[model samples]
Structure formats: structure tokens, C-alpha cells
Target: MNNNNRVFLVDDDTDFRESMQWLLTSAGYDVVSASSATEFMEIYQGEQGCLLLDVRMPGINGLALQQLLQEKNVQLPIILISGHGDIPMAVNAIKAGD
Candidate 1:
């Protein structure tokens, strides 16, 4: 039942990542998580999936990650959620993902 799209999440917030992982798994979706862009890249494996990510992390924020992924042309569907002030930045994220 899980792994339908193999949801991949990368966020610096450990609590949020764990909570989302639990929720997604309970909903019968295979969810993989990473705390940083580096960690996510380590296991990325060029797989196709849906990605849920935060915008500003310690290193390689979501925008930059979108660039990296675009370079590889991995074709991953990404959803970016940022804080209050990051909304404008998140708009850029949408363009980058495109």
C-alpha cells in the first residue's frame, strides 16, 4: 500500500520530518526523509517521486536543491513549504522547480 509515489522529504527540522514520516506512513505512503540536502543527495539515487521540503535549512535550502535536481533532470515533483518571510523566496522556488 505504501511507496505509491515514494514520497521523499528533506527538512532540517527533525521533529517535523519525523512527524510527517509517521503521518505519511500511517496513511499508507512510503516516506523517506533527510535532515539536510547532503543527506538527501546521498540517497537520492535518481529515483522518481514526490518531494516535500522546507525552504531554508542549514545548507542547500530548497531552492538550491531544486537547481541541483534540475541539473540531473530527475523529474521529481516538489512541494515547497516555507515560513512567513520566505513566501517570496518560495515563489522563486516554484520557478526553479519548473
Candidate 2:
């Protein structure tokens, strides 16, 4: 893998976030995480990589953040993970070009 390989992980669940951090790090990808969409937006700098987002967060949620990123012209690939009831929202996000 390239040294620039990175994954931006945004989720409200601490356990899940940490777990994913470990997994991704073990897989040799540089991993960065934020506890919420707001936090992620605050720190993101349009770096080239993938975004791993949780669909059901407290403040902005994943889909809304995706839309915001689109508005800002971010073109990074996004992988949205949702719970059982949030599958539809995830699909909609994907359709919206997340």
C-alpha cells in the first residue's frame, strides 16, 4: 500500500471507533477518527483518502455530513455504515453521491 493511504473514520460510538482504528492500523492504513460529524469537519483538510462514516450520529449524522462535503467539493470515496433501521438512509446517502 502507498504511504499516503489513509482512512477518516467518523462515528459517535467510542468502542466502534477505537475498534476500527485498530483494525485499519493493523491493515497498514493511516487512520484518523472523530467522535462526531462536527469534529470531523473541524479537522478534515480535504486530504485524499476514504471516509468511513456512521449513518446515525447525534448532531449532523452521516448523510448530512456527506451532503455538506459535496457542497464543499470533496471527492473522496465514502463508506457509510448504518444500523438495521438506518439502511434506507445509508442507501439514500450513497445515491446522493456520498
The lDDT leader among the candidates is: 2
Q: In candidate 2, which residue ranges exceed 4 Å CA deviation?
A: 1-4, 85-87
Given candidate 1, what's the lDDT at residue 85? 43
- Displacement of residue 42 (Cα, Å) in model 1 is 0.5
lDDT (Cα, 0-100) at 28 in candidate 1: 76
- Candidate 1 Cα misplacement greater than 4 A, ranges: 1-3, 85-87
**Which 10 consecutive positions of candidate 2 have the poorest summed lDDT?**
82-91
- Please give the lDDT score at residue 14 for candidate 1: 85
Total residue pair clashes for candidate 2: 0
Local distance difference test values of all predictions, in order:
0.84, 0.88
- Screening candidate 2 with a backbone cut-off below 3 angstroms (N, C-alpha, C), the clashing residue pairs are none
TM-score per candidate, chains pooled: 0.88, 0.90
RMSD of every prediction: 1.8, 1.9
Candidate 1: pairs in clash: 3-30
Q: At residue 88, what lDDT does model 1 achieve?
A: 65
Tens-digit lDDT track for model 1 on 1-98? 43355999999988988998999889877888999989999998876679988888987988888888889887889988776546568678767866
Please give the distance, in angstroms, between residue 57's alpha carbon in candidate 2 and its true position after superposition: 0.2
